[model samples]
Target: MTDLASLLPGRFGHLVRQLGAFGGVGVIGLLVDMAVVWLCLRGAGLNPYAARAVSFLVAATTTWVLNRAFTFRGARPEAAHRQWAKFLAANAVGGAVNYGVYAALVSGVGFFAAVPEAAVAVGSLAGLGFNFTASRTLVFRGA
Candidate 1:
């Protein structure tokens, strides 16, 4: 843990540590996702969108492993494969929320449409809270 992570408040310290660790895993997952997508697109010559799907699935699995080992260490003991499935199921809602928010923002707001990347960022942020909640409370309960 960094100095910043070490400074987490006493009462809600677990939440802070989990969030920080989750963020780190997310960064790593992003890299893995990008690499997979690149490989699918450039090496396999697959459709760009399909490549994204492949990458997304890979990254989801990677993040589940990382989160289980780090962010939610000592969570309810269960089969590793089962835990990955649970993570995916819980994240489905978060993914929908993110896509819905992105679509709504880009279509409903002229400013957001003009800067689609910003709309995506907003959508991502909107889903973060729900994802964290679901991951901590449902997917990795008893941590």
Candidate 2:
């Protein structure tokens, strides 16, 4: 009881550090995704959903590269092709989570009716946990 509670805090503290690092990676990835989305949709006249997919692809690639170099750098290299394939698969799931949140906020909440800021806010909050957990376990697993 008491011992379990003490261990819980220690375990949680370690998780907090990992989550923080994971979030730092996510922040950079989000910026990349948003920038590409803006350029493709606003500048190139692509549909919003299509733009989001392309942007997510680009951002996912960037996230993998960065996470390899930073978050999971200590892991012994798996086979190159296998590792990349797994990373891409993980990103596919994360992208689904991300796009779902964006769509829900923008459409379900009528974020388009209220303001762009509301959409961004709601989507970010909704997708944060999915992105963090997926990237941690699937993308950056310790070897």
Return model 1's CA RMSD, one decimal.
Answer: 1.9
104-134, model 2: which lDDT tens digit per residue? 7667666454786766666665566776666
List the candidates' TM-scores in order: 0.89, 0.63
Count of backbone clashes, every candidate in sequence = 0, 0
Cα lDDT of model 1 by residue, 8-112, tens digit: 777487778788788788789889999999999999999999998899899989999899888999788988888888888877788898889999999999999
Candidate 2's C-alpha runs over 4 A off are: 1-14, 95-126
Best by lDDT: 1
Alpha-carbon deviation at 99 in model 1, angstroms:
1.0
Off by over 4 Å in 1: 1-8
RMSD of 2: 6.0
